[model samples]
Target: MRRFILIFLIVILCTFPAFAQENYCKDKEPWKEWDKLVQKYPHNMDIQMLHAVRIGFCKKIEDSTITFEVASDAFNHLHETVYKKDMAVKVREVLDEARDSV
Candidate 1:
């Protein structure tokens, strides 16, 4: 009976969404992927800009589309959070200027 209960709890936890709004950037791959995209086209500000926009887009939307914010806070640079491994979505207002330099 104990074993059955443990299994049931595990299954229930698994059913929940892996990515939650508060901590979506648990995986840094998305931000890393964006960086790689920037490296590919050094002069292509357009593509880089798009990538930044995507990060910010992921943050603004409340729906469970993308997990994480671009997090540009001093404590959390680029896609990092101040005290956590998670990344924050990029804020859209300065996306263009930031990407232009990245």
Candidate 2:
């Protein structure tokens, strides 16, 4: 039983990214950009697609010009096959709404 539990934990830990628990761009300001996008767009589908990979966007939040470019790279890395689209969409929506208040 102990061996089985150890194996299960090892598998689980290896499957999940070490930084998965934290925001993608911990140093960058996720809320700052999230607010701008939400207030101007307000649930726009195009923005939905944009937000689906927000971690990439978050990375460039420090600079306005780099946001889109870095976000593009982030999208490619997302590898939807590994990360579910619905989860990304939901994460984006929640973050956007949470930051919209600003």
Candidate 3:
């Protein structure tokens, strides 16, 4: 019985990371759709902001240490290209939240 329990615990521990990665991959699936939308509407600030946020989210899930730089770059691009100051502020807020999640 002790041996069986030990074997079961080992299996559970080994499988946990796989399950987490599967969910991570599933969560990341939306980025592909977002990419398509960005391609379709390159000038759309909303879509671009969402894409940047998704990029941050995926990076955070994969590795928190590397998310800040990439997310910052995306936010900077949005701020530079997006014409409306108010919209740029909102995009910055979204990027902040994404970075905070990491």
Which candidate number would show the highest lDDT if scored against the true structure? 3
**lDDT per residue (tens digit) for residues 1-102 in model 3:** 323333433453344345443433244544565566678668866556756765665667477655444544544455434335544565888899999999
Span of ten consecutive residues with least summed lDDT in model 3: 1-10
All-Cα superposition RMSD per candidate: 19.7, 17.4, 18.5
Number of backbone clashes in candidate 3: 0
- Which candidate ranks first by TM-score, i.e. highest? 3
- The regions of model 3 sitting more than 4 angstroms off are 1-29, 64-102
User: Candidate 2 has what TM-score?
Assistant: 0.28
Global CA lDDT computed for model 3:
0.53
Question: How displaced is residue 62 in candidate 1, in Å?
Answer: 6.9
Give per-residue CA lDDT, model 1, range 42-86, as digits (tens). Answer: 675444554565566555544555334433231133222211221
**How does candidate 1 fare on TM-score?**
0.30
> Which of 1 and 3 is ahead in TM-score?
3
Tens digits of per-residue lDDT for model 2 on 1-102?
323333433443354354354544653554565456656666554444545556446546646656544454455455343334444655888899999977
Per-candidate count of clashing residue pairs (backbone under 3 Å):
9, 0, 0
Best-to-worst order by lDDT is: 3, 2, 1
lDDT for every model? 0.43, 0.50, 0.53
